[model samples]
Each structure stands twice: as structure tokens, then as C-alpha cells.
Target: MSPRQRDRVRSLVADSEAPIDAQTVAAELSVHVTTARFHLNNLVEEGSAIAINLPPIGVGRPRVGYRLVVAPPVDDLMLMLVARLGETPEQREELAAEVGRAWAAKHLPSVAIDAELVPDPVVLAETILTRLGFRITDVVSAFGQHEITLCGCPLEKIEHELPEVARGVVRGLLETALTAGSPALAAQYAVAVRPAPGGKCELRLNLAQVADSTAR
Candidate 1:
């Protein structure tokens, strides 16, 4: 998993006061339900979080959720790792790019690209993110790039606490979507995801001219 994915999982699990379910965490984290479940289970085994059964409303089996159990100390290994990475901003950014490229290589095969340019890649991108609970307010094209406006942070308001990792996840999401959704334009390009007004996030896809390039 990428740093963003891992950190967001830990953040959601750590910050919550009550037990949180996989579906809810998935939406807030902008990750698949399965991804959230996978990481949550791991955290449970690590003793960082604990799993509990939610009282059923009117069902045979109760629902399961995770609650934060402990906090990583200031000198914790993960904190130290993040600090070390922060020491080299350029390398950290490159690693973030690779996280996106690697994710694209994994999921793009299933996205069904076409021979011709597809109608706004943003549409498809929105669908994927929406399923993970990252609500899309609007999407538009201008200045030769697709702009997507999103509401809700999958990290559950912990984005500023770990901005690089949070942005890294968005970076991967946009890059992968653009590459898979528009193979014809899968050439080298960059994207930016920023916090927006009214508690939203903005994605600006800098779709540039195609050039020979390798995946990050």
C-alpha cells in the first residue's frame, strides 16, 4: 500500500472516539471498502485498534467496527519515517508519484480503455471516487484541463495532520485515473489536488501534450 493509503487508515482508526465501520471508513478515506477492511483487520492484530460488534437493529448477526486503542508516541517508528522523508521534499514527492503510478498499473487493466479518446475522463474518475464516498460537487473543463471538485476527506479531517501523505493519495488517484481512463493521452503529465472552500477538495488535472515517458 502507498503511504497515503496506510497513513489515512491509521489516522481514521486512531482519531475516532467510537468504533467505526469499514464502509464508513472507506467513504471517509476515499478507499474501497475491501481496502478499509484489510487495513483495519491488520490494525486489530497489531493491537493499535480493537474490533467490536455493533448491536443489531433487527438482524441475526451484529455489525463489526473498529475503535482506536492506542496512540503512536512522538518517537514512534512511523513518525520517524515521515520525518525522515520530510527531510527531502523532492524525493518525498517522487515517492508519492510512484504510489500513484503503481496503483494505476494495478487497477487500470480492469478499467476498459477505448481506442479513441473517451468523453471527459473526469466522469469516470468521479464514479470511482464516489463509490468510495468522496462526493463530487462538480466537474468542468477549462484551460485544457479537467477540474474536479470533491467534498469530504477520506482521512476524516486528519488531512492537515499528514498533508503530504494525504495529497500523495490524491495524486495517485488522479494520475491513475487519467492514464487508465485516457490511454491516448497517457503521456507524461502532472496533477494537483488542493483543499477548497465550503469544506471541499479541488483536483486540477494538468493534462499536457503526450511525450515519451516512463511510469513513476
Candidate 2:
């Protein structure tokens, strides 16, 4: 595969939540297994993905799978959205808010704002979502409120069983997220942990209207 094709394959793998094999890649990309293997080996050699060995229950040898270890670029998505909105400040703001709302819908459990504490909740919301492994797909702002759309899971594991190291990682991430355009905006930031359906965990932040937003 060419470099561009390899990059596209990598993006697909990152977007997928589970490990995949060469055959699966071939089918997904409409390429032959040989071609898929070529790119997979190249990615492994470059350390972009790791080869995982899974043993079958019947005492057979392990099968190989590939897992992505890197993330796709946010700038690419942002640039596309910018182009779509045209070259106007109002359009840009609208896009930014749209992005925010979309992000909150997919990634956050729920969001509400302590308007008395922060001037711009959308920016704060985006920061938190980014920290949580959700990429900002789009953004817009209206009447002082910002909206964002997001995808991906920075914290995919169950929260109750989260290790200390994981909690530390999230805490550090939250610290970064809490920092917005100004100290006042930062002070208003807070994330609430709640139980998600199907026994999963979700994050609720102190930003408004996130639940109503949907991911793109």
C-alpha cells in the first residue's frame, strides 16, 4: 500500500475499538490479504501498531492480531470543518459550537453549567472531552454558549476498577481540561462520574446541554 493508503488504514484501526487481523483489514479496505499484510507488517515494524498473540482454547498455537497504539490527527478534521463553513468569523464560531455539542453527545454522560462560575462553557467542555479521549469533530458557539462534537474513548475501562495509575492519569488530564481561556472559566469546571447503562461508567461535567448534542 502507498503511504496515504497506510495512513488511512491506520486511521481506521484507531477508530475501531477492538483488535483486528490482516484478513479483516483486507476485507475492510477491499484489498488482497497479501497487500494488507504488507501494510500491517510495515506498521508493526514502525511501532504504530503492536502484534497481539491470542491463544485458542484447544491447545493450538496463538493467532496474531494487530492493535493500534496511536491516535489520528484532530487538525485534519478541524480543517475540513473550517473549509465547509467558509471563511467567516460567524461561520467559524458556529462551527466551533456545533463541534462542541456534537462531542458532548457521544462522549459525556451529561453536562450542565454553573453559569455563575464560568463565562464560556463550551470551551471548557471541549477541553474535558479531549482529555477523556474524545476528539473534537466540530465546534460552534451561540449567545455565549459553545457546543462541540467528539469521538473516541480516552478512558474506556470501567471506572470502579480503575487502577491508581489510571486515576492519576485522569486526574492530570482533568487538571489540564479545567484550564480554559481564563482562570474564572477554569474555576467553573467540574466532572461528575455516573453509572452508564449496561453497567458501564460515564462522565458528567458541569457544562450545559451536552447530552442533547450528538456525535457526527
Winning candidate number (lDDT): 1
lDDT per residue as tens, model 2, 110-198: 44545456445565556565645656655655654443443324544423433222223343343344443344554444432223234
Tens-place lDDT per residue, model 1, 1-216, is: 677788888888678878888888889978899988999999888888889999865866787899877665753565456545555655665665576567555654375567675546666567556655677777777665666667646643434455565566667766777667775554545567666654534433333433455652
Candidate 1 weakest ten by summed lDDT: 202-211
**Candidate 2 TM-score, true structure as reference:** 0.31
Considering summed lDDT, which 10 consecutive residues are worst modelled in model 2? Answer: 207-216
RMSD of each: 16.1, 17.3
TM-score of each predicted structure versus truth = 0.49, 0.31
Clashes (backbone N, CA, C under 3 Å), per candidate, total 2, 26
Cα lDDT, model 2, residue 202: 41
